[model samples]
Target: MSEPPPEPTSIGTWAKRYYYANRAAVEAVLRPHGLGSTQWAVLYELTTSGPTSQRDLGRVLHIERASLSGVVATLVRKGLVEQTPSETDQRQRLVMLTDAGRSVWKKLPDPFAEVRTVALEGVDAGEVATAIRVLERATAQVERHSFG
Candidate 1:
């Protein structure tokens, strides 16, 4: 008999798998509002962070500039976002959610809550807290090393 295939090594791989799985469920919830995960993320960032430079928004979302440009364009066309040239730096664009976008955001159901509840169905609260702490620490370490 052939030997069993080796297991995947990186934690990042599992994290990505989890993200995609949860994203699919979230996408289903967002569909009625005519939004995808990327679009929703952009809107969420704008709502939470207030008006921000496009470059800064991309950095916050960990999205590539090119990909974010396309998403921003789509949101602009849909009347969900408005992009204006920055007063301080005319070359930079500041993106903000329109009133309609805010209204839609308010009306939409929480996309992650139900999926997260299902994911944590049997997990203990303490264990979840520990996992979150560990992940946050790891993310901070990565960012520190990455920038330095």
Candidate 2:
């Protein structure tokens, strides 16, 4: 008989799996609306924060500048967002949601909220809180080490 596959034992492995699974779930929810998770995140930030420099947006979303450029370009092509040179800093681009983008955002349900509801259907509130705390600590440690 074949041996059973080994289970994931490392916290990092589980964290990665959780990230991918959550992303996939969000993508599935956004796919019908012709949006990806990253695109949705950009839109959400713009909607909430109004116009912001591309540099700031990237930092807020923890997305690399190069990847954000492509996402912004795609949003521009879709007529959902517009980017303009900053009046104070001509080298910086300010990105904001167009009227069409606002309309779309107003109509689309919150993908993360929807997915979280399903993903945590039966989990206890305390357990969820503990899990969140543990993960947040782990993420902070990893990021600290990574950037040092």
Candidate 3:
């Protein structure tokens, strides 16, 4: 008789488990600051890159413009970021971190760093790099299949 399916050890299963676990870890760290992971990413980008156009920020963050607009609006309401018309391109809005944002950035813990440190405690750098490449390839394949 034909054998049944193997145990659930697929890459997708592992990737999803890790995704949820990592997200949970991140949320736990940022919950006290009232920031979601996407918000944290936007703040981090502004802090490191200075003011950036909304279009450019969306591209850099790999987020949709509509989604980024909501995130930026939320930050503006929180007084964490400011949106100003670009001098060279009045049609474009540039997003920059406010003084409060800098303060919060300084105070916030690095969630990714914390999770990575603990998760890779026993794993070697080469293994980590290989895994990253594999995931990247898989992601690209999925993206191409869906959009291409």
The model with the greatest lDDT is 2
Scored by CA lDDT, what does every candidate get? 0.90, 0.94, 0.93
> Candidate 1's residue-wise lDDT over 57-138, tens digit each?
9999999999999999999999999999999999999999999889888987778897898888999999999878877898
Model 2 misplaced regions, further than 4 Å: 1-7, 145-148
lDDT of 2 by residue, 1-148 (tens): 9986557887667878888999999999999999999999999999999999999999999999999999999999999999999999999999999999999999998999999999899999999999899999988887789563
RMSD of 3: 3.8
* lDDT over C-alpha atoms for residue 62 of model 3: 100
How many residue pairs clash in all the candidates, one count each? Answer: 0, 0, 0
Q: Candidate 1: lDDT of 42?
A: 94
Off by over 4 Å in 3: 1-7, 141-148
On a 0 to 100 scale, what is the lDDT of residue 137 in model 1? 92
Question: 2 or 3: which has the higher lDDT?
Answer: 2
Model 3 lDDT vs. the true structure? 0.93
Please give, for residues 35-136, the per-residue lDDT of candidate 3 as tens digits.
Answer: 999999999899889999999999999999899999999999999999999999999999999999899899999889998798889899999999999999
For model 1, the stretches where C-alpha displacement exceeds 4 angstroms are 1-14, 134-148
Ranking of candidates on lDDT, top first: 2, 3, 1
lDDT for position 3 in model 1: 84
